[model samples]
Target: MELIVLDTAEAIASRAADAIEALLASKPNAILGTATGSSPLPLYDELTRRYEAGRISFAQVEGFMLDEYVGLPEGHPERYATFMERNLRSRVDMRPGSLHGPDALSEDLQAACDAYEAAMAAAGYCDLQILGIGADGHIGFNEPGGPLDSTTHIDELTEQTRRDNARFFDGDIDAVPTRCITQGLGTIMKARKLVLIATGENKAEAVAHLVEGEIDPRWPATVMQNHPDALVLVDPAAASLLRQRH
Candidate 1:
């Protein structure tokens, strides 16, 4: 695991965007695994700027979303699908190929999960995965549990998570779905590179736990410790609990 502590949220996002651009430059058609959250908004903004300037193009790039609200409609304003489209897809020039996530109302949920996994497998797997850590240490909605699932599947959102995400629902916690479809930790581990973006004081504890503590599912982000190349990009507030810096 590698750590980068930036002075501010903007700096963190700028540096993360530079790293992603470098990766994309090295592999134009890279399969990028993406997450939707406030932490990654700046990174997406930077990417959009570069694309608009003709310095980068997503024409051949492929991507898979990390998670989605299971009960939300495809066009639901609060859905991950809507988030990505507004924040990313609409800003970039992507090919006709799909950017997949879970089907909220599929007849067979398990089959939908399997198909998502299969689509990723057929895409030659993700080369770089962008992530955001939940305050409770969940990654892609894999909350504290007995064992992390190894495939795409539905997850029951903990109250802590629903509360944290309630802002997206106009402070209406009830509007937040109780469940989500998230990529498994095992699936995330397959990516050649992992970039986790966490900002704000709210995330400090979870960042410290995952980066400094022992490997445990109690803090699912801790599993990133095992990834071949995991990089954490955090603002000073988020890195407040780091015992030591490198």
Candidate 2:
């Protein structure tokens, strides 16, 4: 794992964008794992800027979202699908219909999960996956106490997660879905490389656990410590809790 503490969130986004640019330079048709939420917004903006400048093209790239909320009707403003489409797919050169998230609305959710896992398996997993750490240390909705090797499946959203995400639902926790279909830790680990962006003091403790604490399920993001190639980018506020610099 490589830890890079930048002076600002924009700096962190640039560094993270550099990784994507390098990957696209070498593999234009690379499979990219995408993440949603405010932490990654700047990175998405940077990518869009590069695309407009002709420095990058996502024409043939395929994108898979990390997770999606269940029970939300399609086109809901807060749905992960809508979020990714509005924030990234529509902003880049990526072909329409190229970005995908789990089928959380399926009546048979278990089957939906199986199909999602099968699809990712067929694509050979992602070449690079973008991530954001939850304040409670969850990754892709894999909350604490979940198995380290879980696959695509339904998971009950933790209360902390719901409360944190309520802001997206206009501060109505009831508007947030209680369940989500997330790519498991094992699914994420299959990526050839991982890039995680975190900012804000709220993320400080989680970043500390991810970078320095022992690999334990209690700090779900700590699983990144086991990835052979993972990059962690953060601003000073997010890195504030790190006990060691290196």
Candidate 3:
């Protein structure tokens, strides 16, 4: 694992975009794994700018969302698919039918999870995966105490995670989905490369745990420590708890 501390979130995003640009330049058909939420929005914004400037193109790229909320309506604003449409797919020249995500609304969630995993396998798995650490140290929807070697599956959202996401639902915790389908730690580890970004003081503890704590499933992100090509990028606020400076 490598730690990179930037002065601001924008800088962190720019660096991440540069990496993606380079990857796509060499491999236009690269499979990209993406995470939703504020941490990766800036990276998406930067990519969108590059695409508009003709410096980059996702025309041949394929994408997979790391997770999706269960029980949300198809067009609900808070749905992960809607989030991707608004923040990424619609902004770039990505190929149609190339972006895939778990079926969050399926009545048979187990089947949905199985199908998602099958699709990913058929697509050759992700070449690069972008991630964001939750305040409670979860990655994707793999909350605390989740199995470290788990695969794509349904997960019940923890209270802290639901509360953290309440802001997206107008601060109504009741509006947030209590469950989600997420790629598991074992699945994420299969990616050739992993990039995790975190910003703000609120994420300091999680960042510290991911970077400095024991490799324990209780703090799911700690599993990244064993990934052969993991890169952790954080703004100063989020890196505040780190004893070592990059």
What is candidate 1's lDDT per residue for 1-246, written digit by digit as tens? Answer: 989998987788788788778887899888999899888999999899989998888888888999888888768887888888889988899764456676757878888889888988888779999999999999898888837546788789999999999998999999999988888888888889999999999999999998999988899999889888999999888888889875
Q: Write the per-residue lDDT of candidate 3 for residues 1-246, one digit (tens) a residue.
A: 989999988899999998899899999999999999999999999999999999999999999999999989998998999999899998899876678999988889999999998888888889999999999999999999988998899999999999999999999999999999999998999898999999999999999989999999889999998899998999989999988876
Comparing 1 and 2 on lDDT, the stronger one = 2
Query: Which prediction has more favorable lDDT, 1 or 3?
Result: 3
For model 2, residues 71-143, the per-residue Cα lDDT tens digits are: 9999999999999999999998889989988998899999999999999999999999999999999999999
Predicted model with the maximum lDDT: 2
**Model 1 residue 129 CA deviation in Å:** 0.4
The best-first sequence of candidates by TM-score reads 2, 3, 1
What's the residue-level lDDT of 150 in candidate 1?
68
User: What TM-score does each of the candidates earn?
Assistant: 0.97, 0.99, 0.98
Q: How many residue pairs clash in each candidate?
A: 0, 0, 0
- With a 3 Å backbone cut-off (N, CA, C), the pairs that clash in candidate 2 are none
Q: Which stretches of candidate 3 lie over 4 Å from their true place?
A: none
